[model samples]
Target: MWTAIAGGIQYIIDMGASVMLPIFVAILSIIVGVKPGKAIRSGLILGVGFVGLSLIVNLMNDQLGPAAEAMSQRFGLSLSIVDIGWPGMSPITWASELAIIAIPLAIAINVVMLLTKLTRVVNIDIWNIWHMAFTGVMAYAVTGNIWIGVLGTAVHAVIAYKLGDLMAPMMVDYYELDGLTVPHGTSSYLAPVAAVVDFIIDKIPGLNKIDFNADTLQEKVGVLGEPVVIGFILGAAIGFLGGYAPDQALPLGINMSAVMVLMPKVVKCIMDGLMPLSERAKKIMNEKFSGESFYIGMDPAILLGDSQVVTAGLIFIPITLLIAVLVPGNRVLPFADLATIGFFIAGAVAVHKGNLFRTLISGILIMTLTIWIANQTVDWVTAIGVTTGSIQAGSVIAALDQGGCPISYVFTQLFTMQNVTGLVVIGVLYAICMVFYVNLSKKRAAALEAEDDEE
Candidate 1:
């Protein structure tokens, strides 16, 4: 019976986030007093939106994957480690024994945190619980102990919730996303880095004066600066650079243009489904908890619709490839996950106040670190792949983002006792960043409060 229950969960997860998120949302909506018919419709609409978003994203992957490959060949860049990306890493994580319990454990932790006022985020992005599971499994794999894995997962959940709380103001103020925060491991982990980078940029005299963002571009360049137009131009540029014929490049440009145009509409549908429940939840929380505020933790993909983020991400593709070739000891080619550049930079955009120039600079630094981390973790990533049978016994494997995640790298290193001193240094730096971030958040909150008073 236990095996069957675990298998059942694995089956639901295997159905993918587009299916699973909606089912969970529908159940939650009904529990929150939404009518059954409306709840079902909302859930189905959310699913449709997710499906639409996935389709456009897949189109991007299909087009960009080959271009990145061709670029890699043209540049004579070769690495021994195969960059299988997140698709490969996620399977290995799901296959772990820890995955069976990761969901319930994370959910329970979230509930306890909320009840105790330890967190204000109600995390609904269940699909990303795999990140916690991945960390747990890595600990188990290294220590040969299940309890350590469980503890690691619990700790990871706590960190994610706290990060979500810290970042909520930025999400609301800069991204204009109210009542939602992203707690996904990859995106949330960058918040501290972005905050630090933004702080440094502010201190630089000339660098701080260059004010460029999506709205600024649109205002200065007219129609040419529109995201769809930008996407078309960028897609064509990449295709041409990859040696595609004009005929071939035109379709790729159109596909990218479609993505820019369609992604926002898809996000709108998701927000439509979510807003009602969000309002209801906010009202209930405020009434029950004496006006306490809460945020719903969500996937970060919704931020990809921002024009500046898409533009910066597209520009970073070739930049990342170049960095991979030039950076010593880097063995990942950044394929499969190249399409994820937009999501990676979304937080940076918010942090930099949508300034494309600042975001690009920060993105370069972030990717440089990510590539180095990916290179450093190749052995352990490969081991996990082998243990889960995701890779052939003698095959090499690596992931551009997941493998390079600083949190994952530090935790795995610390738990494995591979490099205790390095972990200690990283922990110190991370703690300092968190302190800075907390102070910044408090100031921003005060400013918002002052503005509210004036209004």
Candidate 2:
């Protein structure tokens, strides 16, 4: 009886402030009417929140004896803290957190909003569905071996972005409050167009700085051309059988990172090193500089409504091919790069909805965003003292891997000396591309600006 009593007492405490959740929701709901952010508790945001909390608290408790499980309990709330794909809680982790926050917040806010005549519940997200979706796709595509987490991010972002919009009757989400008036769940369908924008931006480095107007996303998708035609055939053949970097039939450990992501960056970097003249990309020995773009792309907001999936796919293929060749033997048949292949295939089939330049300029955007995201990832890892080496021992820790990616199960088998060998090989290849790309980009930029001026 005494034991039962203690157990029950612990349960009560573990429930923590959940009992007061309604009151908390009520208070927040009242305040959210006046403050926008106070009303939005999304999954993407939670992904960062959970992971950050887990890391800090786990570190606070010295790694929490193999993944912390009681951090939320301290608050009398049941929290299942774990490693997200990145440094924070992932979709699953955020799901648990969102359940705790969203429902209560919804009830509180909904009740208040209804009473105050603030809204009628039509949408959920405040804005930027395209940004959420594009980032989701990009992150998922580049996650390499951690595909499940990538998918989870996709699902969570989509759901969280429109949670209130879809379940308006029950949720005090954006739709219910009428505060969210962006797009709905159709963002994924438009991913192909977004993909096109990404590819275009990447091709022409700084071009993205001046052109975020992706209004032609749909129109870009509509044009069924060689790039998309070939890309679709190739992507369909690839399917979802392989991941970002699958181990090849050979004994060699293929460091897909080297070829898949790093190789291209290296080549581009080398080209950057050799490029002729760009005020920012190149400087004559010692020169003052400002990070501002030569121009800013139109707001991405205007572009999202008009884009489609086909154009995004067309842009996806060739770029995918570049990375594909670098990592060819690892899982070559194209089935391995489903996200990328899917992108190309879908993009080819999509219809262009706006202008040609919108599609053309996407490549530059991809390059810029990739650089920012890569740097941010590095900064996050550095902050936690966890580097590629710390986690690269090729030993599988089930606890460390939330999802069951086969390669993840055998770390050493996957991350062996092969990583070192592949890096060396690709490093040489990237150096070559770098030299070429840098010069081409510079000349192209000058010519394009002149052309634009003439137009």
Q: Give the candidate number with the greatest lDDT.
A: 1
lDDT of 1 by residue, 16-113 (tens): 88899889889888888888898888889888888988887889889988987777787788865657766668778888878779999999999999
Model 2, CA-based lDDT: 0.28
For residue 51, give model 2's deviation from the true position in Å: 29
lDDT of 2 by residue, 1-455 (tens): 85575554334323322222222332333343423333223222322332333332232233211111221222232212122322221222222211222222333453454345443322222222222222222233234333433433344343332322222211111012111222222222222233334444557876645532233322465543333233333233222112212222111112111122222233232222211112222232122223222111111111211123223422443343333234323212111121222222221122112233454333333322222222223322222222222333332211111121111111221222334543344344334433433343344346545866999
Off by over 4 Å in 2: 1-90, 95-99, 106-121, 124-308, 317-357, 378-455
TM-scores for candidates 1 onward, in order? 0.96, 0.26
Clashing pairs in 1: none
RMSD over all Cα atoms, model 1: 1.6
Give the alpha-carbon lDDT of every model: 0.81, 0.28
Q: Tell me the number of clashing residue pairs for each predicted model.
A: 0, 63
